[model samples]
Target chain A: MNAFTRFASLFGAGKDASGRGGSSPECRRVGEVLQMYLDGEFDGDTSWLTDHLDECADCGLDSAEFQQLKDAISRLGQPDTDTRQRLQEFADHLAGGEMDVVDDPV
Target chain B: MEAAQTERDAAFRSYVVPELDVMFRVAMSLTRNKADAEDLVQDALVRAYRAIDRFDGRYPRAWLLTILRNAQINRTRRRRPELLHDPDTEMERLSSTKSGDEFDPEAVVIDPVFDASVRQALDALPKKFRRPVELVDLGGLSYQEAADDMGVPVGTVMSRLHRARKRMRDHLEQTGFGTREID
Candidate 1:
């Protein structure tokens, strides 16, 4: 499916004649929390979600697609070396009492 | 007094020093400017050092992030009142070469075209949607940490972030990336 239709299925917007546009209860549940799972923030037992993805092709594809997107975004930014060093030095100064914390505006 | 000072410094070093990188990342997301982010982190560090004696030494990341967020809020209130509403202007103030300057060298292993596409997709998001992504995806904050930083509920952060990623994913697919089926 194309992006629009695929994501539309995610929101229960459109479904094919087979009623398989992620309309199943398991798929629906996965759809609701798949991002949470991918984000490592899902709170409860995730075994069912994993089992559903393992057994179902469409859910598996969705999981992989979101995972790919998350991975891509996560790799886009980093702390530059100069900033890291500067922050380190600042921390060192504060730890060493070289900076006056009481007079500084936090 | 000297012994107490030495103990406080040791505690500050042990608790706050190791989290400098994380503080910088979260600060960058909050300020969206390299200089402002550095300043904010320093301010947060100062606050953290002052409070290190009272800190219970658990979840130091969360404690430091809370301090950083509070510092950003106070800084905004005291200095840049305009930044409270104008995300576009804030985004513009972000260094043009920020991505290039900060792109992790290890990420060079990934496809350049794909990375560029992802950046474009991210830039296209609305500021509300974009902030959560930057905090969680880019800054490595957990959902709750991002929620705390953004002053929103965890569910709200999750919803915005999930929708944002979906939009980015759609954009990537339209740009002829990540559309193929997995093996």
Candidate 2:
């Protein structure tokens, strides 16, 4: 129907679909489930991938690291409380019709 | 007071107020500066307030972020000829602040140098790939949600994340942080 439909329906793509050049016999199919595998959501055997991780240099090195990176990246920023308070005050003012649009400082 | 204005304010409370923090963080990602991020969020809220009738009463976060992102882009285009700062540079600024005893090295276990190396590799990723990582992994958005926010499909988001995580690993391995594990 569209490019998206085409890309997604390439059914047998499995591991190569990710396009990171991680395809290999042991990790080929493994790549398809790597993200889920890292999250402990994969359906099949754990040691199947775990065994691959033990044997496959790439999977061993990267799978664990990806999890760490996910953690690291998520740790980077916080919701600014000042922004929240200001937005609240702004919302209150707008709600009360106390501020005109022409003089809006925001 | 106009009835429409009162209704809009009520709608803002029901739809917009709860998302202020999320919108602020998403705004920060786009603007890379706190003041600019706050300004962008504020402006986006005003714009959203004006367009509240158009909202479907669903996907509030995505709606606000889409507005904030567009506002930031339009403003950036008007004010500068280039991106405010590359994500890599912005990420480095983030890591710099987390340094010098605040991170509690004994608690985290990853060496600070290696930690910085990991960040460098992540920042080194192409922005298209990096942005998906931010939206899905860092931003805690579902793949479909990120897809909607970025205007791509879920498959594209997954592909981007897969490639991005793969590349980050390759970079870490090259830097010899491959064996290091985080607890």
Candidate 3:
């Protein structure tokens, strides 16, 4: 493990941790599984989290809040079509080419 | 040099041009400022051109994002002096979390304050946690991909990502708007 990983391992093991199958490969917690869920990596019914989410209202709320947060974060930083044109012109100049794509673009 | 530029221009047109919006959005997610995002995207585009020869041309968006992420980091590292250590100060102001005393996620569908809350919560994360979250959550990189990009284990990525999200939720809970754990 790298220094950061080792540091994380030292200080990172305890907050809100409710893991299963400790010291085993299949071990996962609400935190880890919830990460997968937000990443769209959770295999739905096949995921180990399925059972936990069904039984734990807290985890269920965690799931919903994470989904909502993901949507919120995803909706940020939207750029219009003109942004592409502007960036392309910038790239052209950065490429040692003239700014011929968009005339007099600032 | 001229001939290589010509070839790079063609390759860039084919591979990179289509992904400008993705790069911009990813830049915005990191910078949280339109002006900064634009500047970062321009830097990344320049770096991408310089490194375009190394890219295999598939997964153009991913390739550009990697470049953009690195550019942002380098920029952050360079500008960070002892007096200006915290790079997030500027971003936090842009999101302006002053109104998050009652940040409601459900009520945030059209609320800028809720938007600020989410961004502020992300800003509050430790570097170890935030990097993976930004890579996987914001940049849409996969576990293995984020692991490789961040040079950490896949388990580490998952661990940090989940921890970061949990912390974000906890912050939202503190804001008096989101659901809190039943304890």
Candidate number with greatest lDDT? 1
For candidate 1, what is the TM-score? 0.70
Put down candidate 1 lDDT per residue, B1-183, tens digits, no spaces.
Answer: 788789899988888898887788778667656677889888898899988888999989989988998998888778756555354553343313345445455555444446556777888899999999998987888998888878999889988998998888777767665453322
**lDDT values for all models:** 0.74, 0.65, 0.64
lDDT of 1: 0.74
What tens digits encode model 2's per-residue C-alpha lDDT throughout B22-123? 776677556655567678877887777777767889888888878888788778878865656665665565455453314434424534445566557766
Which ten residues in a row are the worst by lDDT in model 1 chain A? A12-21
Superior candidate under DockQ, 1 versus 3: 1
User: Clash pairs of candidate 2?
Assistant: none
- Which one wins by TM-score: 1 or 3? 1
In model 1, pairs of residues that clash are none
Ordered list by lDDT, greatest first: 1, 2, 3
- Put the candidates in DockQ order, highest first: 1, 3, 2
Residue A20 displacement (Å), model 2: 14
At residue B75, candidate 1 shows an lDDT of: 85
| Per-model DockQ | 0.39, 0.18, 0.22
Candidate 3, TM-score vs. the true structure?
A: 0.64
lDDT of 3 by residue, A1-106 (tens): 4211232233343433222113333334664456576577776564566666655544554455566677666645555445656786776565547633322322
Candidate 2 or 3, higher DockQ? 3
Error of 2 at B77 (Å): 2.1
For residues A1-106, what per-residue lDDT tens digits would candidate 2 score against the true structure? 2211222233323443223424577667777787866644456678787777666555554454556667665544344455467778886776566766533543
